[model samples]
Target: MDWIEANFTDQAGLAALLLAALGPDGDDGSHDRSHLLRVWQNATSIAGREADCDRAVLTAAVILHDCVAVEKDSPLRSQASRLAASRARAILAGLGWEAPRIDAAAHAIEAHSFSAGIAAETLEARILQDADRLDAIGAIGIARCFYVAGRMGSGLYDPADPPAGRRDLDDRRFALDHFGAKLFRVAGNFQTEAGQALADARTRTMRRFVQALLDEIEGKSE
Candidate 1:
């Protein structure tokens, strides 16, 4: 079965806006279809533990969270979520969704962005933010770190000081620097209790990986 069929039991409610939800297909793997799928999976697991979540609202928010494409270094990066939220409202309105539900989805989409620096007011908004942050840590997060680095033409790490001891942390130049720049700090940003727990564990995994990667870079065994 395809991902939607396997991960989600029923999608009858979302079928109408499914295409619009996918947004403009982008070449950025970090924010691609698989990313949306993973976020949905994360949101589902978290939502099951949280109280009174609206599945359709959460699903719509998850799918369209990244509708507006913005690069990591783009001048418009901080506004990406707002742009996507605006677009999401329009898309759902076209689907003839009620005002309240569309507003819920829009809030979730906008607040999900770390760059936006906005608080997630509702349960779905908090869940979406946490769910998206979940994908930015752990084993998968490690892979994406280097993947994005390669795309940005940044090195894996500083050759002389892998820990970035002397010089300032420059993630734009070194992928490893990102752990300090953002990854290590995201655990505390999780909103829901379940999401915070999962984030703590994933952040631990990332810590271990970072130490090991540094050890390998320094040619230290064990």
Candidate 2:
């Protein structure tokens, strides 16, 4: 218990420091501060029952997960995990965190991304992964898609033009294509039951939204 307290104390302090460093731009209403908070909340909810999970590690990873996002020129396209890991290590060390715990937390943070290609390796990582994926689905996911798409100067949907094969698809592609390409694929990647359920449910909602958009384009929906 004492060990948990000590390790977790350091983890919490480091997380707070990173959050402070991140400041306002990290709250741009697109997977920003509040979104991180929600991911923390969601991770806690699912991870609480798993005895093998470390609450402190999971919490810290969730909060500092996107710290490097602000540093990137284009977060959606750039792989910021390496930068995030570097920043996370420094932040943890500044808070007096030992090598092992800091290393674990940093690894978890780096592995939490869906685009980063480094899959979840631990139960704690899995929880963080699910929580982050949840944010990329459902209502919040929809909002974030547009927010990011707008940031990247993408269109909402292209009625007349079809997906111009794989070679031409870039950031300029519509927000709707993201669902077909990635968002809809999240459910299959989730490692936990809670994540799977949320992904399944969110995928349905997204499908409905996509179908409705098509209906509207075809003069079917009101």
> TM-scores across all candidates?
0.91, 0.85
Backbone clash pairs for candidate 2 read none
The lDDT for every candidate, in the order shown, is 0.87, 0.75
Cα lDDT of model 1 overall? 0.87
Worst 10 residues of 2 by lDDT: 162-171
Model 1 misplacement above 4 A: 1-24
The residue-by-residue lDDT of candidate 1 on 47-80, one tens digit each, is 9997698888898999889888898889999999
